[model samples]
Target: MEGMAITRTDMLSVADTVAREKSIDREHVLEAMEQAIQKAGRSKYGHEHDIRATIDRRTGEISLARYIEVVDEIENEVTQMTLGEALSEKPDAKVGDFIVDELPPIEFGRIAAQTAKQVIVQKVREAERERQYEEFKDRVGEIVNGVVKRVEFGNVTLDLGRAEAVLRRDEIIPREHFKRGDRVRAYIYDVRREQRGPQIFLSRTHPQFMAKLFAQEVPEIYDGVIEIKKVARDPGSRAKIGVISQDSSIDPVGACVGMRGSRVQAVVTELQGEKIDIIPWSPEDATFTVNALAPAEVSKIVMDEESGKMEVVVPDDQLSLAIGRRGQNVRLASILTGWDIDIMTEEEESQKRQAEFNERSERFMEALDVDDVIARLLVTEGFTSVEEVGYVPVDELASIEGFDESVAEELRARARTFLETEAERLDTRRKELGVEDALAGLAGLTPAMLVALGEAEVKSIDDFADLAADELTDKEDGILKSFPIGEQEASDLIMDARVAAGWFSQEELDAMRAEAAAAAEAEAAEAAAEAAAAEGAEEA
Candidate 1:
């Protein structure tokens, strides 16, 4: 190897070849060669000598030198020297100047040549990693085709031609399999620069994987005539996708299903026979929810907008189909429409309504000192609360069948007296629990709410101010859980309590509210677009 003359031209040509082969810059390879040469020079001389090497960019001529730093005081005898000693070597030498000494060029020996090869390989690999990172970073969210390179445990590594990717075990479709050399298509969900290299994570179970598949199969989706609004999947089993069309004449579902189900069949085949339900998307939540639960007809729907939940009523026979095997069908619908859904049969819903009616009837009977007949009549007329009974127009109450002005006046008198007694009892209970008058008097807080808070030991304005909305509105563990208060109303009451507790001036609170309102407005706009676009219980 020493006798084999490596010409400067050959050295430069080899650098270019390696750079092209590794898809790295030639200059980077040359810098790596210079470092290897420098290391070899240090090895040839004393290890303590400070050696550095440089290569002529045009000529590829290698130069080696020993550098001694000029310092105020010498530290190491070989690498550093005093200013006086450096000045003897060069008249204008400064404290920080390096005094260089040229050395005879190194001829590559076996060990040195092997060391140089290792250095070049490592640097080229790093450059390749950086290049792959830069190239693939923007390609996330795209479907990529790859060949299985290896399988370790359940995870599969894919050779993506220019780079490699991993299909994590959890990200694979349930029961799917891949072996060495198997072709695969997956969504590039994440790409990260890891210590080993740039890691590209692919997923066959991602909801978007199905969307991308549709884009590949459906020309309308690819052309933007139809758009996919949302996707929900039980991978390797079933899926639902919400699609809408800008062109009203072009049916979104038919376009996705294609002629005789050919298009969807292709996607199903690729997904290992996972079933698909192409839901026609709508801006209305109730409409979209109905469409998402296809093959199961809905009789009626009741939505609670504040809680982002809906109750779907279906025929008794359709319950099994609506909820699916292991509740997968309703679960996917909930995920697609972005609403927590409760599915109940017609008979079940009727029983619920009758139970509520009986409860209200009992409440009226106890509050108004009326018999079951009068209370049942009042409940049937849509009177739900004692407050409504106490404050409704006497003429309206009189207009009910079998009730005249005299009966209406007597009923109103009893209702008002009962409310007065209940309010006094709640106020007494609140005071017994040490609830502050300031907290009791806050807007949006009724006497009943105060009693609930006081019972929960939130006794002071500070306690009220420190409370979160969920502390009052969460279903299972809330102070006023039984109250009709929503999270936003609870949040406002807490802020009011904070202002009363001198946590901040009203002006500061107003400013904070204004900022919050602006943010809420922006977020609501995004939510509206997405609602017009739809997460419920658990996102698949």
Candidate 2:
């Protein structure tokens, strides 16, 4: 029987070969083989018995054993043994010791051999997948070249030597086609380990793909002399890259463009003739945005820093060029700069300015009962609203180019009268609309806003407190109609309404108010700090 026993030297050699071929650890292969053998051992013995197998690494000798746990009393006869029975095998057997019964080597049957082979194959495949995932997980965002294994429904599966990657249809460049055995290069955007295997996702249309191509073509970018700040792509149509140079002597845009545009042309050729814009980056958003809209000269840029928006003015002839066909140029610029860009012609800007002037002048004339010349002066002095004229320091109003103290006084008086009359009219309407007086008393809730809330069935302080900030301030449709209020203002109003409705105790409301005041102070301090930093940067 011992002479007929099989030696596992061949098994060890097979594990080594499989580990080498699959690029997995030799121990993983051996452990998988041990599990397979242990399963077979259990089947040959009894399913109720506790069977385990271990392979000697040096000799490839497999040892099969049945383990029984020593206990004071045996509950499971198959796995647990009484101390008396355990001590019969070993004199000093303890309660926790496992009594091992060495068993003869398993003889492989036809069905058992096939089952072991299946388990080994399954485990090796899993180990291969894990190895693939570990190898490629850190390699994401890198450009990889592979041969197309298959093309199924416009999706290409690339054979990446050891692993496979899927280039989805939407991730492929527009109109780009590949067939079996064709070489393809793509950016590894994602790598996910799934039950079947590691799924490597490739993309040719990602904005980073364009950036990586430039990094390959341009030595400066690869070596970090020129850093890519941002990238925006419209697939194969066009792309924009924002780059900044560390060395003052080197031109970032020129470095990326290369000699005679060779570097950019190489990238463009790979992208199926996609146009590339290499713009010099600036810390100043206005300068960066202007640079992003290259070739189309910008006459002026009016930026609203708070809104992250810029109104770019170009010459009338350059308007179409700045906007591009179907607004692709400006759209790409917006994406590149991370700002909302509104492009307008110089003529259009002038007309808009004139229209704003007329509107302000007319507002002042009506609100202050002033003549056209006085209204124009007030508008030119940056007073757009009667509220500003009414509440501003009298000395500030008098300091306007054409206004004296008496004129300022009279203008302010008229502005005050207009506001008082308007407020009285709105208050009367609010009363008629059945708005509660307590709701009107809430700060930031104007008579008009209260009337609008009343019309929306939010007539009480309770109703007002129950409304969300957006429910009152949403631009499209809200209780306040087209009235635009900031989130902080809405929050403050809601808290005041809640307090007025006796939703919280006075002490609780005071604590809440204190918290809000502290938040406001912190926010104001943050804003001031940012403003000072920006001013310092500007000065520097």
Candidate 3:
């Protein structure tokens, strides 16, 4: 073993070659070798090896020495040596100084090579994992340009610059298709470590994607000249967007639409023919609402601010168009405008107008008082009406503002006088309209089928009878399904039929059924007689 041809120079050069090839530091390789050799030495020797390892950092030279302490006499087998024996190798030896003892030449065998290779491979794997972890951990929420690698079950695999990302099935817009090797941009939503590798999640259906698309296409949006106020999408079918402009000079709608519909068409083509509605945003909810119901003219908008509701009236010709097929237009407009919208045709509006006219007419007939709200406020202010505050005590009326005692007394007298005359007039009108007789027709109605309704005090045919199917559904659960009728049919049954008991006279219904049977019998008998005549003629 001592006569082996291996030299330290050869090992040093070989260490440098291994370190460079594996992209590891030369000193690290040397340290690994020293550890391996120390382990081997301890295995070969029964006791721990008195080994010292040294390396030249630049040259990658590693040298190992077995050492013993020089002593007057050898006391331990591993550490101590007789001074005369130590001085034989070294002429000047001290009692405590280390003495170098070269080990027998033991060339690194196949076992050592295998051990070094295992360590190198393990270190490289850990390094690679660390490198990949550092690389992707900082890439969240970014837009990555990638190529579509493949599509499986509607999910897409994209080849990002340094890794791969998955676009989930639902993240893809409906009816959109991508071919392999197509270039695309995606929003990097998440980056997570997984068993296979780093998993990156990308999305195209996200609302932010639309905002980014607008930012890219419309310079006004990017420059803050126009702002996208709200967006509601039925992904791939249609999208409604509300836009506003900070500068009065810019029309937000036209800016989004571009000249001759270029900008919107670009976005639409990218969405594969998805329709988009670009409506100008208004701070005034009423004005915004009117714009939201675009492509159809609206007659009026009555807003109920407390409920965030707006009842819109459109011409009869435009009602269907405004409501769209299945009410999609108004529904989208509601979503876009953040209001619950109710649409009515011009005819329905006219009926409502007439109803309101009748109510006003009745109020006019009974107008012996101020408005209800004003009356309530007056009572709170220690006055009941204009006449009471106007005529009786001017000081008391003046306390409330704009009314003196004389004015209060005059108002009180006027109210009293108006009450008497108005009551008479109302009575006359009620008789003329026959409203009392009409209500009386609903009296003493007891039908078993309508027992639940009767228990709820549905005395008038016009009471429960004027209710919509949905209202009836709330009062009596599952009635809509049981009835299985359209809104018009239900309306007709409630309004036209009045009550089941009074729907038709039983005797009249029986007579009609009997007449129908008789007519059917007469027609059958005529047919039989004609057949017999034909048979007789043929036999003759």
Instruction: Report, for every candidate in turn, its global Cα lDDT versus the true structure.
Output: 0.91, 0.89, 0.68
lDDT (0-100) at residue 376 of candidate 1? 94
lDDT of 2 by residue, 67-106 (tens): 9999888789889989898888999999999999999888
- Candidate 2 local Cα displacement, residue 47, angstroms: 2.7
Worst window of 10 by summed lDDT in candidate 2 = 1-10
lDDT ranking from best to worst?
1, 2, 3
Q: Which candidate is the best by TM-score?
A: 2
TM-score of every model versus the real structure:
0.78, 0.81, 0.47
Which one is best on lDDT? Answer: 1
**Cand. 2 TM to true fold:** 0.81
Please give the lDDT score for candidate 2. Answer: 0.89
RMSD of each: 6.2, 6.7, 27.6
TM match of model 1 to true structure: 0.78
Which is the better candidate, 2 or 3, if ranked by TM-score?
2
Question: What are the per-residue Cα lDDT tens digits for candidate 3 across 41-73?
Answer: 554553455876565666545566788888776
